[model samples]
Target chain A: MVKPMTKTKFLERLGAELGIPPATLREEAPLNSFKAWDSMGHMSVLAMIDAELGCEVPPGALQKCKTVGDLVALVGSKLES
Target chain B: MITQIASHLPRTVLANEGLAQLYPDWTAEKIFEKTGIRERHVVDEGECASDLAFAAAERLFAGRAREADYLLFCTQTPDYLLPTTACVLQHRLGLPTTCAALDFNLGCSGYIYGLSLANSLLQSGAANRVVLLTADTYSRLIHPQDKSTRTIFGDAGTATLLSKESGSRLHSFVLGSDGSGAEQLMVKTNGARFPRADGLPTTTDESGNVHDPACLYMNGPEIFNFTLKAVPKLVREVLEKAKLSLDQIDLVVFHQANAFMLEHLRRKLGIAPEKFVLHLEHCGNTVSSTIPLALEGVITTGRLKPGMKVLLAGFGVGYSWGGCILEW
Candidate 1:
């Protein structure tokens, strides 16, 4: 069985995928503030979400996210459980 | 069996440093870490996919081009929308007039599909030897400043010669596609469905990558998700069809899409690092040429040898995917 992915784990994984230092990222951080959140980084985030949580975030849905918190919400909504 | 495999890259080279100069935020090391692409070759002004294909085929043939009884050219970027590129290649290569030749539009999954066709033609006694050429100059289809694509794709063509043999065989293949996800990675214009319009419209996405209606557009996350779902299943189905397990496959080579994705799949599928092959560091994603190029690399390095069971999987573009086991 897979570990239940918590919001904290989700953000940490997302930050790791984007190459963000662990303690440097705040939950309310704007998604656009990070230089690594470019197109490739965007793809990495979604892949990370799917790999870490097994939830495929629709590309359009990702486009709607403004803050890292919004991304967490989008991912949480798509969780299989 | 694939008797020989040859690959060709265009003259112009685009290194990550070149890309970093354009997109300052990305350093060469940073780009390499993410994509595992150091440099990619692109075609020059007068060059095209066919030219590269011709060159690679010439090298593959080495004056034996006339022995081919059939020719198959796999590409998405054909020279002309009218006469098929394979026909022109046949004549240019001096293949016999009786040879059956045609072009099939496929991307990363092309080499597998080409091998499948060659297998059919040989098994049916339709042809004695098949010239399978997979080439694509995706650089022609990409927007100039689209860092996402420019950093990932490079142009290349590869020629693989296949012939029926008693000892070695091209085993069964598991091929797949999903058109519903076609828009995820595609070029929207320059086709019968949507002819080119003047003043190509462009849009800038949140990632700052430009989307030109006339150039390539890849929804990276969507394709990644598709791969995450499709590839493992494809691997399982192919293994079942062959009645073999992962340990039995001597080597595994998948399309060199990107380093991150390939590394992820390698781990997710429980594929051992030493058994897997990655040739993307220099060539980047050469579309259809990737698998063959990787094969050629391993062959030269002695990683692939006669009697070894090699598993090849190609997935992407057309949302197409395929897997097959070959006795090398």
Candidate 2:
């Protein structure tokens, strides 16, 4: 039985992966608006998702990512694969 | 009233091989004269932080003096991101897993923080024996060609066995941090995905790119300003915390960054030049291991008689400084 990944778990994982305090991240949060989502932060997201999702997020996929909603969509498609 | 300390240092020495090649005109002797450094030990290539850490740990536990129940490892270069070096060390040392093991990712003020943590743990009856290790392979992070940092840092590690004050132990410590000026001294890459994020070649200074390793950067004047302002105050505070006056202390083991800074600090603190244990002439700044290594090298020949008061202080990198007094 496979458990479905939800926005709540994904965001929680994202927060932990980036070493950010949970409350600092929001569903409506624009990633670039915060200093925490810089190059390192983005890489941490990519690594964390790869480890948990069992696949690479694809080149340039991260640069395309701007908001939490964008990240969710990207992650959701990877889940389908 | 700083706590007692026991320490172990690496047996090998690694001279700054990169400096000579980068600055062809400068000689090692000249570098030594300027920085108060002769040579520093670097772990062989492919060696991880734990390997160097284990060497020190083995010496610390070799005598089996007293049962150590707590393990605290202070290092900036850890072996793994997931399992803290404390746990791995605990497993390797065969200490009971139930005992608390923690990793403090601190560099210069590591020993002070380690002592403070041990004191708190002991005062609370959490544990009587604690093992604190400080190790840094700055050479691993340093750009081979960046003369600014290359000449100043060296690779080395130290392990201290802290126990309850049976006949002798630690006294007290004073510590401080300023986050605003953290960037003044740091390894600006290879952390939290900065350079490692994409595997695309990251932009680097001409000298730094030659080796492809993350280079330690410093704003020399800013760090100097930070140290000049903080070190003396912190020393006074630690002495006060220990309830001792400057005259009552015997020896001072400061972070051996360089001769100029140490001399300036000695002058500022009004401590007689003889009160300082001089090891920088032989071993460059060993980062976190400086104070402990100095203690080991000095105790053998420097006449650190029992029950004499000594002060240990460390400053740099983190824009952090810490000091403590211990009765040998």
Candidate 3:
């Protein structure tokens, strides 16, 4: 069975994996709009989280994530479901 | 015709010093035992992707720079947090500022994507001479302690010149992306924060924390399953798209990921082992450069003759896979 990734953990993990500093990545923040989080960078982030954290963010979850906050909420929702 | 197009690599190198320092006793053989890497290069401490990109592009476009009108750089590692490295490279290479320049963040499949993009531009008359550069300084993203990715990756950069030709250029390309398996290979931590979340945890893997930047993690078995399942299918598709059969290809330049994976892939594809070149022994798993390096090797060795058809493919990291057939 796979464990759920907490909202906080997910963001932290996403940040670390993508090499974006925590100062820039905020909740409800659009990932691609950020300096570090581009399309491929986002993919790398998601790939790392799914593999290392054992949590999978579904397709389009990225679109739902308007802010870093929104991203975490989405992750949390996914975890709960 | 797609004759001997230009390509080149950088001279002053970084050479994976961090990874080397981390594992004093680890050699390419032992590291590759688990992951599929024999060795890799690293950028010099201060050097970024653009340096290598510019170097390779300069060499590949030398005496031909003024001829190119577009530059495409595919890499997971770039110099800045903002401007695309392609723009910097274009300026540095003295390319026309009006030229089309962009950076693509991709891993193993990068080279093929670059080629595909260049082909489209050329076919559309968007450009006459296209410089495609693929480079990754895995040293930049890899965590020293994370055994999963550290072993499999090595920093490398390669460049290829795509020109508008009459007969043969990029024959056909097949590309696919599956988001479901995206997590099988990743580097996590240091991105954004949920409202309640603190900054990234600096804990070691021993702490049982999920996100750690100190390493690259991958479900080896899962990736293996994905590769075995998708690669052969894609290769066949690309071959079919090219209107050629496997037996017709003079050389197969699959990504130089590892000896073991390549061995397994070849066996699964039923490809004669001899049709491909094995340069991973020294160059390690150079991700994007794998195919070009292989092409360079076969060309330098005189194994690939003019007019020979070549099948090139790259897959890894993003669950990304792509391949193309080209006539030399």
Candidate 4:
């Protein structure tokens, strides 16, 4: 059985992948505010999510996410489903 | 067996700095970092694919214009739809009137498919020598203001000579296609389904790139996703058919789509950096000419040696993909 990833764990992993401090990733932090959040960065995020969370997130999913919390929720929903 | 290869790039050059002038938000450094393309060759206003193909073939004929029993020209941009471009090339190159010639319409994956066709011809005793030519002027199809396609595509032509030799070996090919994703990378107009009509409005996308129904359109994310799903299967199939493992292969050459995507594919496949061939910095994606151009680079640079096993794979435009192994 696969265990659901917690919000704390997800934030930690995402921060590592994006090279951001976990504390800096506030709930309402805008995704575009990050200097590394470009097309290549988006691909890295997708690859990291698949590698760490075992969830396949499409590129379209990232486009729909505006804030850090929204991205976490997207991945969490995929995990739960 | 591929005996000789020659390529021709147009004289006009479009540097990244020139492109930066069009899109102020993106600098040349940013563009190069994103695409690994510093510059691309652009054809003159009146230049066509046939013109470029003729130049490349002429270069190969400089030493000696040997007569070929057959000529196969691969391209999407032909001089005319009625008469085949290959037929025109035979006359332009001064080949015998008895030579057989035809053109195949494909992009990106055209090189591998051409090799497969040429190999089949030699094996079946259809032709003693074959001249496989690939050329495209995608620059002509691109809108001046469209940065997406403009930054990634360049104009080029390549000619490769294949002849039968004792103990020459070419492995079987593994090819695949999924037309359901065809629209992901295509020109919506100027074809049979959607003929070009005047007064078509131009629309701009979120990236600030303008597009007309007649111009080329590409969904980067969708193409990337399709590649991710297809290339792994392609690599494995070719390796299986050749009875070789990843470590046994000396070189792996894939379509020069972009630096970012090619590096990602290399890492995903666990291929070593030295074993992989990447030459897109000088000329951006030349569609069908990419593989042969890269092959020419490795050979000229002395990286590809005799007795080395090379794996060639191409994927894109038609959502088409193919793989084959060559014993050099």
Q: lDDT per prediction?
A: 0.86, 0.71, 0.68, 0.86
The candidate with the higher TM-score, 2 or 3, is: 2
- In angstroms, give how far residue B72 of model 1 lies from its true place: 0.5
Backbone clashes in model 4, listed as residue pairs: none
TM-score for each model? 0.93, 0.73, 0.71, 0.89
B317 in model 1: Cα distance from truth in Å?
0.8
lDDT tens digits, residue span B1-328, model 3: 2333334443433234444566664554455553445455666678776777666666676665355688788876777756888888887888887788888878888888888888888888888878788877776676556554555666666777777764666868899898787777765543342332246465542212133543455655456556766788899999889889899988888887767667767865768977876777656677787787778778778998778888989998888989999787
Docking class of 1: medium
The TM-score obtained for chain B of candidate 4 when compared with the true chain B: 0.97
For model 2, the docking class works out as incorrect
Residue-by-residue lDDT tens digits, candidate 4, B1-328? 8888899999999999999998888899988988999999989989989888899999888887668999999999999877998998899899999899999999989999999999999989999889999999999888888887899999999998898962446785999888887887788887787787467788986556788879888777667767777898899999999889999999999999999789878977889999999989989999999999999999899998989999999999998988899888
Residue B66 Cα positional deviation in candidate 1, in Å, after optimal superposition: 1.9
**iRMSD for every model:** 2.4, 18.4, 11.7, 3.1
Better of 1 and 3 by TM-score: 1
TM-score of chain B of each: 0.97, 0.89, 0.86, 0.97
Clashes of 2: 12
The DockQ leader among the candidates is 1
Give residue B103's error in model 2 in angstroms.
1.0
Report how large a share of the reference interface contacts model 4 reproduces. 0.04
Measured with C-alpha atoms, the lDDT of residue A1 in candidate 2 is 17
Q: Write the per-residue lDDT of candidate 2 for residues B238-292, one digit (tens) a residue.
A: 8878888889988998888777567656865678988877777656777788888
